[model samples]
Target chain A: MPESSLRGALTEAVLYILLALYTPLHGYGIMQKVDELSHGRVNLGAGTLYGAINTLLDKGWIIPLAGEMDSRRKEYVISETGKEIVAMELIRLQELLDNGRVVTGGTV
Target chain B: MKHIVHKAYWDYEKEEQWLNEMSHKGLALEDYSWCRYVFRDAPAGKYIYRIELLDKTGSHYESQKYLKFLEETGIECVAAYMRWAFLRKEASLGPFDLYSDIDSKINYYSKVINFWNIFAAMELVIGTMNVLIGLVNGGRYGGLGFNFFLGLPLIGLGVALVKLGDPLRAKIKRLQQERAVQE
Candidate 1:
């Protein structure tokens, strides 16, 4: 599995998906988690979610759990590399937040 | 009770909407093959329908797996024809969509556009080749050959298919610009 570059800002969907996979989840579970995490603001359609999951799997950011293939639905969890990407994304997001605060002169 | 309707659809979105409208009229889509749709009686607005062009044909292993995944998500594969699958979810499951974000929508459109463009290009090439062959053979026989007549219609069909992709290409351009600014 190839690792995608971690330099750019992750899309909102990718970030939420990585966050969602902190715990093992199947395709539907991931969708539900993303919806809940965004407070229903982000509703992932089945096709889109499927595409994202496959991309994540290909990028080695997520891996299917062992012994879950007996059933039709397979479970996936975030990989070590995925966690590292998430950490970088957090730092990038924090920088953006800090810059926003400085520019707007609003303290939070 | 089974009700069958023969309809031709050039646009999948329009087909989806028409299927949904049928569902609202108590006709739930049961199966689809070519221009034929089989419907069963159900309550009005009982189901919401969606159509997608799979990366492979319906019988292919990958498409079957994808359909299985969709079924696990409470979306049912109502029918499969060629590379197209018709899916429906219970209307009560809130709103159902196959693409939630702009990026995925653009990706879907790209797939569609690519399919049409390739198909149309093949038609154009074959049609042009047939026409040229017919013309050369006609000059030898002192009249237009049958191939010439056949090729004329094929070329027209190819041109129409290309024209059909125009709006989708425009839609992709607009979405790309939107993504550039928003993302």
Candidate 2:
């Protein structure tokens, strides 16, 4: 894949994370959901998943939902701000899809 | 194999004591040479090593460096910089102070220009009087010649000062307005 197209995957990672946390999920649970949703095409490493969780928490897009089951495990949920951002992203994706359909004569 | 290495040019006695403490904790001293103490099977991540120098004034310097040779190289790792005191010190020096000094100098220049503007009208009056006195004395006193050399440069300098002041004064006023709005 071209380097320029890598940005799309980054955006997809953020969206996938938000989707996985819709019902409040743990770190490993979210990673599993991402892989399942993408049919095993988007497996996230533990380190990468932890780093993403930290970044999302720092940005106020996610928060700890409940107490950890064990010292090594943590649970997280999406915030209201995160929901709004995801909704905005969905609208953007719809617009892109519409444009692509028009430009490709409804083939996309 | 995991290892922790501490680097220092002095404090050999304290380093030895620390090595012994680590040994008691089950972290075997793998090697010690050239101001570095290496340990095997040591827990990785962040750890602080404090060495106290036996000086009258008790001079102290603290350094913070990440020890991540294993993690970076795909091995297990636990490393951290040693703490100076028991408490984590807040960073209160460096770039922050330099930025504040720059802001103060700009503010000072703005005030100096405002002072000059309030005193500028006096120069025209002084220039007129010197020209009049020179004409009245009929060229022997050369008052106009002296004032011309001195007063003209002062006038030019004053004009340059005002020109320089305009932009800085505007910047200061804009900054003040922004702060007022923020408050």
Candidate 3:
């Protein structure tokens, strides 16, 4: 993909991870949820997910939760702050979707 | 054998120019970032290289640093605020000792500092509680004096926190300034 396209996708990728973490999810789980929600259009790699998780943690939008430790896998959950941000993002997306529907004669 | 590794945040245009400049100096640009230049074949000793960052208006910010180590094989130096590791097959290079020293010092200092910050914050809370309690009792039975004594230790703790972290803070600031100059 083009660099600009990749940059644009990053914002959505971050939101998808936030949405997936509402019930607490691991890295792989978040990737799967993103693909599912996007109808398989967005397939985030492990490296990208790892980078996103660290960035989200640094920004205080996600927190690691206590977990069973059979493997090195860890679980994360969205914080209260993260929930609020996600809600705002959803509203913004809804507006965009509505605009698109109107432009496309409500077919989409 | 000589090896030169350039490290920096990738900027294709500027990097191409930098490569050209290095080529002119007879140094090969193996790798790089926006803020780092690694040069091999430097004489065995400490040497300082200057870095300059230019703004759109043509104004510049600059910094200088010594080549951390140099041996017959390659040179190991650090610029900007980033750490790097490089190897060249042809050259016998000395290990970059600066990173290890800085890392150990940072580890030691951070541990000491985190402990001190928590301890001082706790002391502040405790001291405030003591003073509040003494005031509520109207300073009866020398309570005011006792609270004042308790508060002194908190003040001391705060002072210690500042003293302990000050040097590290300054070092980080210096490093940041150097990085900005290399941008």
Candidate 4:
């Protein structure tokens, strides 16, 4: 895993999605999880969700789980690489918050 | 009761809005083929409608998979024509939007603009070629060949398509600015 490539901050959607996939979730479940986690602040539309899922799969950050042959509801779980990326993101967010408080001389 | 109407719309957003309006009037879109829309009576404001252009034909495997994914999310494809699909969801299912983020919206606009640009370029090229052929084969001052006349409308259509893409480009610009600030 290249730390340099993951240095950039993940978009809100991608970060939320990766967080949501801590447990295996299908498409609709992922959408619901994101919505709930964001407290309804983020709504993942179908098209955007589809595109993001494909991109994440291509990057190997997520792996689709095989279900029944007749089942169209494909589920996914975060890969080990994805967990490392999420950990980095957490550190990055903490830095942002710490920086804000230090500069403002007040708790954020 | 069922009602059928023939209409043409170059803008998918406008078509979507029009379909939503029809739903408000208790006319749910049952099917669509080309410019014809078939509607059936239903409770007013029963469904929300959306339309999108696929990168491939509706029958293509990729497109079908995409549609199937949407179905799992509770959206149904009412009809598909050429590369466009008419989608609908129950109005009570919260807000229905195919693109919820600025980046995705911009991506969609880019796709539409690219399609139109290609169409416009093809029209302009064919039109210019025909005009040149007509002028060279027929006299320049008079007796313009049939190709010259045939090319005029094609050129006009090309220009029209370009003009139509301008607003979408403007939208993309605005969305890009918004993304820069927000994301």
Candidate 2 displacement at residue A55 in angstroms:
1.3
Q: Could you give the interface RMSD of candidate 2 in angstroms?
A: 16.5
lDDT, model 4, position B81: 92
The interface root-mean-square deviation of each model, in the order shown, is 1.1, 16.5, 17.2, 0.7
Q: Score the docking of each candidate (DockQ).
A: 0.78, 0.02, 0.01, 0.89
Runs of candidate 2 exceeding 4 Å displacement: A1-10, B1-183
TM values, all candidates: 0.95, 0.36, 0.34, 0.95
Q: What is the C-alpha lDDT of each candidate?
A: 0.91, 0.52, 0.53, 0.92
In the order shown, the candidates' Cα RMSDs to the true structure are 2.2, 20.5, 18.8, 2.0
Question: Which docking category, incorrect, acceptable, medium or high, applies to candidate 1?
Answer: medium
Q: List the residue pairs that clash in candidate 1.
A: none
lDDT of 2 by residue, A3-74 (tens): 744433125667889899997887658866987899876655433455467789997899887565443446
The Cα error of candidate 3 at residue B1, in Å, is 34
Best by lDDT: 4
lDDT of 4 by residue, A1-108 (tens): 877555788999999999999999999999999999999999999999999999999999999986633577899999999999999999999999988999999755
Q: Give the candidate order by descending DockQ.
A: 4, 1, 2, 3
Q: Largest DockQ belongs to which candidate?
A: 4
lDDT (tens digit, per residue) of candidate 2 on B1-183: 657576763223355456546645656555444555566654431232222211112122211111111122121222222321111111221111111122333444454465556545465456556555546564766444554555565566555545645665776777677645431
Clashes of each: 0, 9, 11, 0
Predicted candidate 1 versus true structure: per-residue lDDT over B12-115, tens digit per residue:
87888999999999999999998999999999999999999999999999999999989888999988898999999998987899888889999999999888
